[model samples]
Target chain A: MNLAFAEIQETIRMVQMESLDIRTVTMGINLRDCADSDFEKMNTRVFEKITSYAAKLKETAEQVEKEYGIPIINKRISITPIAEILGNATVEQAVELAKTLDRAAKELGVDFIGGYSALVHKGITKGDQTLLDALPEALSTTERVCASISVATTRTGINMDAVRQMGEIIKKASELTKDRNGIACAKLVVFCNPVEDNPFMAGAFHGSGEGEAVINVGVSGPGVVLNALKRHPDADLGQVADVIKKTAFKITRAGELLGRIVAERLEVPFGIMDLSLAPTNAMNDSVAEILEEIGLERVGTHGTIAALALMNDAVKKGGAMASSYVGGLSGAFIPVSEDNGMIRGIMDDALTLSKLEAMTCVCSVGLDMIALTGEVSAATLSAMIADEAAIGMINKKTTAVRVIPVPGKKEGEMVEFGGLLGRAPVMGVNPFSSDRFVSRGGRIPAPLQSLIN
Target chain B: MSQKRAVVSVIGKDQVGIIAKVTTILADNHINVLDISQTILQDFFTMMMLVDVSELEDLEELQTAFDKVSNELGLKINIQLEEIFQSMHRV
Candidate 1:
């Protein structure tokens, strides 16, 4: 046989048994051309442009999935951040534009349409303020629209004013969607050092520097990594890292091939492949499980940070060698609700908000998909965002917070968002207040590392 | 056009006419079987066939035919483009 038996069998096992699959193939379409002074004309242009460009996205992804015999789980679209073209629109017009985006997403048959975003790392413009004001309404009213705000970056300090506003916006969104356990907040993310080409939703947007249209793919294979580690029980930590690297190489190669084919068929440039080990709600498909397989009894316990740091580095090392262009948040993800092992850890009291915050320092993203109590003050939420932004700013890595404060839910209780958002136990936050600190609204100065020439 | 190749794999309890059944479908679809390898590990029969699908259209149709054969013969049959394996296993 041209291919070794073990190689063929390994691929089969990875797909069939382990939950190896492409998480998303996001097409970033520049909507700057769709901008117009007239609100109705702008909406029409935006809708038409997205529909025309992404009309074949779903069909092409399905065709590729059938041909490769691998699942492309999500076909999504990311546009130029809405705030960019909002110009002088009012908050009501911004919400209407979000509805148009939601309509475009539905027309294209994509589950989520990202880029309802605003970048306010340094300061907020009129458009940014309008979008921020419209978020609570736009997110609650729209089904498929995902929003993100970049509140901090290494080059520009954390925007404390925006962070404080976001905390209140999150609370209002939760209250608006109180019936659905704050599902709207699940569709919103606050980012620090956000990537323009990230294929994952709620944090994905086509930056100003991106092309007219590009294809970015996110590959997921925590189960594949977990199974590889399981096969080598006695290997030392160094050898274990080797196993993860080899597995990641294979996963990234498959992702690049798939992304390139999709891009070619669509006749667009292949942007990048985000080799994030994004976990799902499925059993045996958890990044926490990989950490535990590395000898941690439970995630969020002591030594979890070291284990995650090792796994994240090895994945990057392996994936970097396989793909020529690796960008976005390309490391391990530790979203509690989306990962079953993490949900279990939360239920067992082994995982807490503090531990997850620490884990974010080493992992790809931060404090992702966690649920907190409704009574938790907006000040506390803002403080949480500040802490995470600090980590991302100082370390010069991307981090984000996508916490859902389920109304009427408290710690140790479960809030179910269903589907990929999964269900997470409401985690306890510090009862102490950071009201005075966050209330003093001003930008935290950029770290000295940003002074690099 | 260059040859479009695929790998068809079948695994199940050792049984009769497994090769005949799978090859019959391939032959009907005008797919050329370039190579074949089979082995019985314990009581399970595992077979792999590399075939050229250049002339074939509608891969889903061929997959459906294989699925029917799979259900009838009590074996698991999967047909995937050969490039998937090569890209992952090779440099």
Candidate 2:
């Protein structure tokens, strides 16, 4: 009896040419242990603990890569919000801590350290207030440090108080380091149910219920899926979905296998797998291309959003079926520079920040990969962050920005990140200011309808 | 009679002496071809053969016999355990 096999390479079984490897396998290290009454001791603990716990991340990632042949792009550390840890310290001390955290990440070869953050969703706690106050300086001075502030939630509604204050804080953050602040705000995400085990950046922090030194892998492959779709351009939606589902299964298997090996070697519990379709700056890398191929002529058209909703939902469904513990922003990422199509489209007026915002409701992260003028003020920066957080809190999704205000550049200019580092063209900003409105510092109380309900 | 019957299929382009080359090896191993069907679908040739392997003295010897036919003819072949095939295609 003969059992025969068909040649897969021959029958157009979708060849993935430029697949995006998992960008970051971030290990979120909660730093509640850094809490101390003595300010100096607290600072030392924050630096020492984060550095010590995260020390093995790069080495572990390299070993895992060697064994599995999967390249881990970033080895990152996320911690308990620094504001909470720096409660007893002065603003200057907080900035120093920012520097120290940035230094620690650099020393460990970690790309960026997150959890320079705060949560004022309910009300501004004393520690949260301290971090908020020191944000402008803390962010301005640090090199490889990133920060986020969640000023609203569905349960708590919008914190008009924190929101207004953040307008000033963001304005200050932008003004102090106007060039980087725009880009920095993009990395810093404000969210509703900000997941703890998120292995992505600035918004990615060690939320409360996580293990000590676990490895969480965030697998991103929009480039692979997009290329697959291109091959089956004539296939019906069902056929397209089947192709995506099968492809996701194989890609996910790669991540799971690598994560298990890393966890075993490190002798720690493996964390949840993040299967977000993170894009890069490659020519074919884009969520827009998929949407464009689906129907729309360009990404930001009126029909663009509906197409995005379909693509994002389809991706989530396919990814969810493939992996058991599917968490993080497990949807399509519409980041600008990361997707070369988006970058070109935005420059040519095919996409706008407002249109990007509309699509964010259906997609995963909000206002990601956006670039603005370096001259843009922090108040506007905060206003922009607040606007995105408003979307996340209302919709109960993880929306974020990697808004880069390219230093010294005006609108229609680009800031380049060499290699997988994407380049973003600075888009025009809302000339209007919410300084007076944002100055009104009272918490935008929870939606009134919800309270009665 | 062999205790169980398994079906093996070979599909490809048929050429001169393809069946002689395949059936000769089966005969040499005493693997009596129980029933056989052959068809040409367009340019491609296909064949399904039922063999009584349960009585075969050695499964490896029968397999080696089929392997030789496969190497010479460039045929696509599938040999399936009856139960395994049934379980895969169960109602």
Question: Who wins the TM-score comparison?
Answer: 1
Candidate 2 wrongly placed segments (more than 4 Å): A1-16, A178-187, A374-382, A406-408, A417-421, A448-453, B1-91
Worst 10 residues of 1 chain A by lDDT: A444-453
- Cα lDDT tens digits, model 2, A254-316, are 566666666677676788777777777665667778777765677787788876776677777
Docking class of 1: medium
The two-chain DockQ for each candidate, comma-separated, is: 0.80, 0.04
Taking the tens digit of each residue's C-alpha lDDT, what string does model 1 give over A1-453?
679988888898899889899999999999999888888899999999999999999999999998888999999999999999999999999999999999999888999999999999999999999999999999999999999999999999999999999999999999999999989999999999999999998899999999999999999999999999999999999999999999999999999999999999999999999999999888899999999999989888999999999999999999999999999889998888899999888888888788888999999999999998989888988999999999999999999999999899988898889888899899879989999999999999988964554
Each prediction's number of clashing residue pairs:
0, 30
lDDT of 2 at A393: 70
Which pairs clash (backbone N, Cα, C closer than 3 Å) in model 1? none
Report the Cα interface RMSD of each model, rounded to 1 decimal: 1.0, 12.0
